[model samples]
Target: MHLLRLRTDVAELLLSTQGAAVLGWSLDTDTGRFPLLRPARHDGNGAPDETAAFPLVPYGNRVGGNTFSFAGRDYQLVPNAGDRYRLHGDGWLSDWTVEAATDNSATVALSHTADESAPWDYLARQLVTLDGYRLTLTLSVENTGRDTLPFGLGWHPYFPLTSRTRLTAPASSVWLEGADHLPTEEVPLPANLDFRKKAPVPARWINNGFEDWNGCARIDWPERGLTLTIDTDPIFSRYVVYRPDTARDPAFAGDWFCFEPMTHTVDGFHMPGMGGLTPLRPGERLEGHIRLEALALQTGYQRATGKDYPGP
Candidate 1:
């Protein structure tokens, strides 16, 4: 496991080449240690289920039945997880080539060719830089194929869920999960699930996608005195929040939850809005950036400090 470490006076980030995943991010503040993102689990290939967070390229989430129609042609994708749905692109599963690195920054790249395993050919890059207390990630994907293809980019970060963990990301609405754990319908934000006013993640198991995201979210761990403000570029207009129910899966016993910043909704390819899929001409590139800033919330300052990070 080759680990790349980036540190500054008040913050540190560890990135592993395995899946271009974030091993861990924390603050070395005067108050104490504050974990910003969930720690990585292993050093193998980037395993989205194990790593703290990984990049989703080409597309994110499912495609409903592993098939879709694009530009009048029908396409079929290989189901990765149990052959049910195609997963967060192949970039996370393949090792990335280190293009450049420094004391506080690293750039990794991955090249993929159209094959039976995947339908598109592309070159993807992830550039991570540490500046003081902020960790910025610039992610991009380029269509290297001969024909036009639809693509999207995103980040799958597992956030540590605490009893007092609260979330705030104003979205236009949300998608209700269907029996397959994919989205079914888009509806108004429910009172309890709506974070327009900021609210704790409900104890109940919930796996859903929010659309027209405001390009930012805040996660606060009161017990740990850690607060992470996640802001992203405009390319990403969707976000997914998932908290598994312990009874459904033994793996749900952990203290982590997912607050994925996505460029499109889950199964967006088949949805009416096409889930924000962008048609990319050959050689065209899609890029976006995300910033995760950690702070130690003081006693009297219980408020979340994430302002509306504007999008394009």
Candidate 2:
């Protein structure tokens, strides 16, 4: 499948035909990469990264392993191991059609039917735009099924590495995961998980979700002479941090890290009052926007672009 690539004067972004996923996002003026979506593996044909565009739908995480009950009826989705329900959603791997594109942005759309096996037909759209030093990504889903369905949205982006790369948020608690990676407990942020101040990712494995998160996060890359501040409208109350253990994934044996802005925790559908699961009524739509600002740390100049954002 061919991938669609979009560019502006300041940045370049890639969108895959499969799942219309974002493959790569980088600032055109700098060497830093913005969206760390992985590259397609090269077996021989020189293909793009297959797992780059992970679906964040029907639920961001598992639902007890491809099975769940809604309205007293049982629903089954494709399993992604871990005895945890279906992972991400079906859209990530599905091919998406590019509807429109321009020098500064592009829009891709995909539609799926809710059949007996997977009873959640929906229409989804993803728009990516690069304005000045800022890049914005927006996703929307419309429920086409006769019945309401649970849903959520999240973006998994890999950021360029730098000694100054650090994260800060106002999170009070984090979800404890079982061996199977399911939510086991909601514990207060321990001294290690605490990120009130800018802290380097410790030399340990982390694949946990945080709750009670404020709608703001900051990443500073001093070596690149840039600092990115991400601010989401209050709709995003949860965040996920994934730091692969170098011992396990030798490919990423360095200080690289991920800062995921999500609507809720994994399996939030089962969690209580934690922005749990989102339900979209038939013909209803779910929409959210992420605003990113890129500032020249040394020059103190900034620029931004996103939904409803004014030009720099």
- Each model's TM-score? 0.91, 0.84
Candidate 2 residue pairs in backbone clash: 19-94, 36-158, 39-49, 40-48, 40-49, 63-85, 64-85, 65-84, 65-85, 66-85
RMSD of each: 4.4, 4.5
In candidate 1 the C-alpha lDDT for residue 271 amounts to 69
lDDT string for model 1 (1-312, tens) is 467888876667888877788888877644666667777765434355787788998888777888889888888888885647888878777778888999899999989899886789999999999986678999999999988888999888888888888999989899999988888889999987898767988888889999888897887777776677889998888899988887887767658889999988888788665768888999899999999876664422222334332221
Tens digits of per-residue lDDT for model 2, 1-312: 566677665556666666666676655333444443334344112322234444365446666566766666777776643334566666665677888888778787778887654677888887877776676778778888889877777766665555567777779899887877777898988888888777776667788889887888877766665567788767678888877776877767555666777887787655554355677899998877877777653221233332332322
The count of backbone overlaps in candidate 2 is: 10
What candidate 1 gets wrong by more than 4 Å, as runs, is 42-46, 297-312
The weakest ten consecutive residues by lDDT in model 1 span 303-312
Score candidate 2 by TM-score against the native: 0.84
For each candidate in the order shown, give its overall lDDT on alpha carbons.
0.81, 0.68
lDDT of model 2, residue 259: 76
lDDT of 1: 0.81
Model 2 stretches astray by more than 4 angstroms: 28-55, 81-85, 273-275, 297-312
**Highest lDDT, which number?**
1
